[model samples]
Target: MARTNDDVAAMLEEYADLLAITGGPDFKIRVYQKAARSIGAHVTDIAGYDTTELRQIPNVGESIARKVAGYLRSGTVPQLEELRGRIPAGVRALTRIPALGPKRAMALHQRLGVDSPESLEAAIHAGALHGLPGFGEKTEENLLHGIALLRDAGERVHLGVAMPLAEDIVTALRAVEGCHRCGYAGSLRRMKDTIGDIDIVATSNRPKVLMSAFVALSQVTEVILHGDTKTSVRTGQGLQVDLRVVPPDAWGAAMQYFTGAKAHNIRTREIAVHRKLKLSEYGLFDAVTDELIVSKTEEEVYQRLGLPWIPPTLREDIGEIEAALAGELPDLVTEEDVRGDLHTHTELTDGHASLEEMVAAAAERGYAYYGVTDHGPKLYMQQMTLDKALAQRERVRELDGTSGLRLLHGVELNIDPDGDVDWPPDVLAGFDVCVASVHSHFDLPQDRTTRRLVRAAEHPCVNIIGHPSARLIGRRPPIDADWDEVFQACARSGTALEINAFPDRLDLAAELIRRARRYGVKFAVDSDSHAVGHLANLRYGIGTAQRGWLTADDVINTWPLDRLTAFLRKKQAAGVSRP
Candidate 1:
């Protein structure tokens, strides 16, 4: 079976974890981890390459390439199997708990005989875990909370995690000789934050050939079924991908039926039924005459139903169908509409790229402006002190006009638990823009969190609120807050809320965006990029905006450079300096 880049990366990650657990050489552990990182970030299919080409990848050396080849050819690596035998799989799972690292988990297994989340939870509840080295009552409490969140999060894969694998599979299907068209359906097409399974639809004359090609792809680790028109397989990342081959004429109807929010389809069918028309995966037909009417394209289907074409991202039956009927459907924000990125980082703090490199990447994307907003002092580990911030500001000023792209010097100011900002007014005033965000106290009471956010929005120097919910998908729940009040506060203070585009942190989720829109609050769809490759994350943010029914005019970053600067200056002029 063909293994995707993610598949190889997952195996390497497992090897690294096992090595760490077994007290293997530090250098070997680091090598596996680095190789995993590099492969996971790679855009192309790693399994299609020969051993020599694999070795050419940045972190893949001779040993790693050989291991990859061995795994791809057979099913398992001998060393990895041996390590698994030495360490129970349960012990590895224990390391995933919030406060537990491999070292801590191993110590627990060796001393307290704990090997899984169940056993650890038992120990904590029995008060047997409190006095352990590096662990206390507070740590135990935190672990319990983390475990609950993990349980609640369940097995859903983040959209970011599943998208690349889905795209690769679609590309492979499209390469089949008889395949006329191929694309993913389901929630992926709808752009949901999390996905349970991937659904792909293809139009092909030779179903068997397409099915064979799909099942034989390197990413398929297990074939669940292979039939004339459908095939299902499980990828290395544990994602179930189901492919359906349909006649070319039924492509549109099949796509609409499969790419469903169920409720949306039900509503559409209701309209068809009322109009004496029938709708199904086959085609739309006149119910009385039993004659086919439309099926070739989705737009034709919508037109027959007296509605305009609905973007896939808004197919959730969340007022989209109604909007279409009224001809009020929004011209949703697209990647091309964004003129700049306002929340980004560089090497002056936690980012990997330099200021100039980041600017060049933005310019390559045709962005007229890009903001350099590194972490502020309160971030501690990656904090930029006042003097460092000033020096960076000067550096930005000196290079401002030299680059074709306009650079905005800014800081991601830390918002404290009680609603205090990291920097004083005068310091914040020196920057071109200020993005205030909550970095700590994620578990505060709802009222307190709302108050904290409201205070930040009310701050005169604050131009935008970054990652309003402060969520790390699959890892942490969103902070509790009165979202309506917070949205109103931002609108009142003219503070734009960010739709942080980082895959792991697409904050101000689609539902919240819709709610905020009611208050006439503006938004900024930002990449929150730290590296050059991260600049491409802007697409995810744009999808989120479209899902929320936002248009280009509703997002500040979509405005031209002059309008954006004028808005920032207006906010700064009204800002009150702190004592």
Candidate 2:
């Protein structure tokens, strides 16, 4: 019974959240919350230590250490269990809404008997919140929007969270003696932004051994189903995973069937039917003879149906079947096509890593060039001033080409409500590149918001529009805009739209990217990285680009260094002298 830092942290946070809902003393509650954070963030395992040793962690006193020992011993203490008995779990779940706090969650429960997200939504729609203090008509609207956000995120985990776990499991299982092939499938294999569940497919004769190994995985919190062919388990993060063991001969067919977007699979089955054949998870077979045709590879199956093998990303049945029939499938972009990251940060702003460290890391990635686009002065709390910006520029000049990477000094200028940027022409012209983004004013009416974005894109000094939609996946809905005008402005002004790669804000979402492409607008698949490690998020961004049907030619970052810099020079080429 070993516990990772996240495991301990989650338990502590849950206890603190429940405590707040139960109206515990403020000081005591604060003490437990602080201790929980300390234990969760500690570099070493808290379980291996005695109570006295545990006290070495910040904020953990004798009492807190005893609680930690209790948690490690049986996963909970008697005190926490007693509190859990008094509070319904749904009440705790209510606090997950963005603006809803523990106090309000409790208020809803006691005042209106709303204890869950579903009940809370019902209350909002029924206008039950109107007369309550601090709850207005606007509040009601926002709550409804919040519920939709929750629903959009329903039952699915972020690909960032699920992919690593699946990769780990697949790697381990592939090493087992009986396994012939192993990999994750479903929407995860399709590279969807959010995944419903993880599916692992393994081809083996000894299904019993595979099931035993899967159930015995250390990350498993609960085992729901266990059998020879299929086994299901729940992880500590509440993600469900299923492992299916099939015969070695059925490996290719199982991979294709399970890796499916249902509509795409339906199209394949339809083709099979027309060809006087049968297609199933087990294999493909002849209709009349009932004989196996092709089940050894996806390519073989697709070839038998008169088409080339389609990339998993394009298997969403969105014009892909027709394109395959015409032999016009796009050669989608890949991580190797990207030359460098354009939107990154350093310690001068909100970034955790410094210029030198970030530079060395970029060099390690073998980037042809890299851009340091720290927050401009408008962000305020980052304390960026003209002096600081210039000093960093001097450093960039010093480090340029020192490590096989040509560095560019840049700024992520904030676009204000009126669509104005942080600096005047000369100041902006000082940087090698500029990326503008909307940081606030998310609730503007459609026409006004559209005008705001168009103005930003048409700025003479702005080289790129960063995270155009400003949506935080499941947390914030995309702002309403007449997007055709936005893309047209980008095309006219030579301002590339960003495919920001931060896990939470994979901005310029796939649907919009496709539309923008139709406008002949180019894109930069930037990591939008704040730390060196954040650069690896490029894979997710590439996934999004492929989903949008983007090719290497559609992305400006895939160009050679000279071509990319020429694209960045649109500011100077605009011939508009700023006042």
Candidate 3:
């Protein structure tokens, strides 16, 4: 039997509530909460551990240990099951939405039977929710608005998705007379965490021609707003897109104005002022003469001030220009640099695609090779045992020889709370690569959590650390851990850090990757794709690599199959016998 992180999280959450109800010590409740997180982040199964092993966990002791083991042995832990009966499932779901927390969910659930999104919406519509305590008109309206926003934003989308759509429009607009340069601007240009609208800025002598062309783009669902200098439309996906056109002479200034983080532009203007210049959408102007000075390109605008042109993505005022002046600008990662995808699941272990299908997808993308890693047996979902993993690997070998894409069969083996892989040493060794990840135990303290991952990285078979922090941006923060020590240990041990490209969990944020790179640690840009559509996120992963100043050489995936294989084999040879 294996326990998942969700199981442990639910259990500990129930236990903490029970402890509070029973007047248990505050620290004691904290322990269970921490244990739940640790268990959630545990790369392996918690159920595999016996009572003594569970007890040995940093936060778990005799009492909590017994509870955890009991929970693993059966579908329900006696204590938590009893509480689940009391708590409405709808209340729990409420906490899952952004901008809402458990306390708010609980209150909404208890007051108006808002057990689900539908019910909450109904309550809001009828004005029934407004009468509840702490529910004023403003709060009620805001909640309703929040719910609508969340409902509208049903799925995650990024610049990659929006860029092509925008570019296609730009291509058409470029054909119009007088069009000089056209590209996406705004958050899409800055590579912000998320975007609601696409902003396109075009420079040409014939602004009217460009603007007219934009209004007629094929993807436009509805023309929301249109004008000579600017035009906006609603795309089929409910995104608002706005386009602006300006004269060529002011193209550089116009681009700088449109490619704004507002704050970054403000700073740039301040810098211009310090240099006795006036900055605007037209160009840098002479302060005393009130005349346009710099022109031609955005690069020229920046170069006039002794700064090199900053890539649109690195335009955020995170020391980009300073680094630029010193010739130390971060070498952002690019799509062509990624050599392999380390964390892909196949039908063998809860992946939607068959092994062959997985191989074909990678081959089609021209990936040098990919690690066909799937979940190992632990939790109930497609519990792939050692025998299953080996069989999958053998099939992968046959496919690899003929598939044209290098296929390395591996498992997303779980590490138990006691810091052990789900399989025996021999079993792990039989594979080409291993990615040790924490699927459960998300609540562990900084010290214990760091130790758990360190233990996994120290394993000989493990080639890469998958989704090191397990954070889903704007949804869930990564578990609190000593990042410096963890990255340092990974660096010393020669483990590669993964940049998971799932839009929600762009784990190993660019900043972290940059820091890790300073220590000479390598990175893998993985889609952690569960489906074919997810493969496209590889570019987002590459963008992260680029923002981190990573070069193709710094990425293992960019290595040709031969070099990548050698890197993996080298790790295996250096590893000690698995305990």
Candidate 4:
């Protein structure tokens, strides 16, 4: 409902893509992209800033800063609008398809008058593309496949984009006088990787008072529905938000009902039915007489139903009710359990923040230890070299224990197609941590993918597998691996898998984390952060880990520094080479 960094970055990035499609200069295109990244990663919101203040964001030069200021002040940039008017929207839409860059998009529009995916597909099928330069038969097939992938990705917004907006609304409404309670629910509360919409619940004697504030808020662009009980509104960005008000006594039941997967609510209602009780948003009541039994707290509702309160993340009807019945529900990991973050970046690589700024942020979060794992050489665009990495490590050492945050000088080593990492054994051994990850070769066959990841996990130099699936939510699908075998390899190798909390990439997804935990594979809940602002993404990682049923015991970053250091040295203890 509110403007986010994602919104700003997306607008600027679209301008860049459209410029490239129009034969804009390569260097200029790169400038827009870089400014998009810097502005998106800036710790503070740029919406309130003037041109001078906006220029503080890296890569936002005089001209770019002025454009950003224009956007913030007037909600549009003239240049971007002019470009949008010139290009057919579908031409820009073509770039969203995998393997279809701006060049291909432009070619499609120019050669075949295929301005959209539908037209492009028709052109391909009508054999209109047979003799085109890059649109061969194989390319057509791949294009069709890419279109299907894009379709399946759907239009869900990333959790990163939705959470802050919802949190802002909750905070604002909670301050209204006479408001009894306020919180957001639904899948956002469940901490899903993406969100379709947001649900907020509140209790107040004056329903009109809350509804007035809800629809009147600056975020609400259009009032879709208005009623005493519920109100729905659309944001300028088209995210729908529903606000519901109930009596104070119905607060708990209302929250539980709204914060639901259909399966979970059905199961809870069935439990109530079995006990000759009734469960509804109003309260748990006597099934026959409708006498309210419990309506005040979620714990009481679950207690009356002969179950323990399940965490919102586990309310997916995935054996959570059964586990609760058996008193075997997991002590799920919480944000507080995280004592440090093991995967983060700096200006040394792709991150917008410098080493000191990132470290200061970590210290502010009261982290006991933080690993600065910048990109290594294979991510060539970063131009990271041994000399650069060493220089950063030296700075990290200088900063360690300076502000009560122990710094682990680390590198995010790219796992090559052959399962080898970026650095040689001697070089890798020098770092306090080596987070090996798959940066490319995402389309390898399942067998090769499985073997590749397993080999990386078992590598003595590799400590954590960063974003193991290498997924980008709706953008890229996870690697198809025989994860059971890989998990077994990691367990035996004492290699920890990372639960990257970078919103779009909540990698080593919940299902994989659960499966890996069965083999006793430990995990690191890390904010694969690229900015100072990104450090807060760890909460999403914690949610992801909880959904996977991880306890603090299953996560290495939750351990005290001594134990974490010992665990990091496990590969060294194994007496191994890449030696």
Which residue runs does candidate 2 get wrong by more than 4 Å? Answer: 1-154, 576-579
Cα lDDT computed for each candidate against the true fold: 0.86, 0.85, 0.74, 0.88
Residue 484 accuracy (lDDT) in model 2: 80
Task: Give the clash total for candidate 2.
Answer: 0
Return the top candidate by lDDT: 4
Estimated TM-score for each candidate: 0.73, 0.73, 0.67, 0.73
- For residues 470-516, what per-residue lDDT tens digits would candidate 2 score against the true structure? 98877887787878889998898888999988767778887678778
Q: Where does model 1 exceed 4 Å of error? A: 1-154, 575-579
Model 3 TM-score? 0.67
Candidate 4's residue-wise lDDT over 1-579, tens digit each? Answer: 223555788888998999999999998997888677666544345667888888777678899888888887788999999998888999998998868999989988988788888788788779998889977788898899778757765378989989999999999999998799999999999998889889999998999999999999899897867999899987877688999999999998998899977667878998999999999988999989989999988888989999888899988766687789999999998998889999999988899999999999999999999999999999899999999888888888888899889999999999888798887888988999999999999999988898898889888889999999999998998887877788898898889999999999999888678768888999999998899999999999999999899999999999999999999997788774431
Summarize candidate 3's per-residue lDDT along 1-579 as a digit string, tens digits. Answer: 123656776778777855554456887776777677556544334657888988766567888888878877875677776766777665665655545665667777767778776688788889887558877887776676667756766454565566677778778877787888888888777665567688888887777777777777778877756888888887888777888877778878888888866646866887899999998887899999998888668889998777888887777655565678798875656786666787898777677888778778888887878888888776557767777777777788888856567778877777666557777777777888888777788878777887888777778777888888877766667877666677787777767888888766777877677667778888788888777767888877776676676778888888888888787777667765443
Give the root-mean-square deviation of each candidate in angstroms.
19.8, 19.8, 13.4, 19.3
lDDT of 4: 0.88
How many residue pairs clash (N, CA or C atoms closer than 3 angstroms) in each of the candidate models, in the order given?
Answer: 4, 0, 28, 0
Residue 259 accuracy (lDDT) in model 1: 87
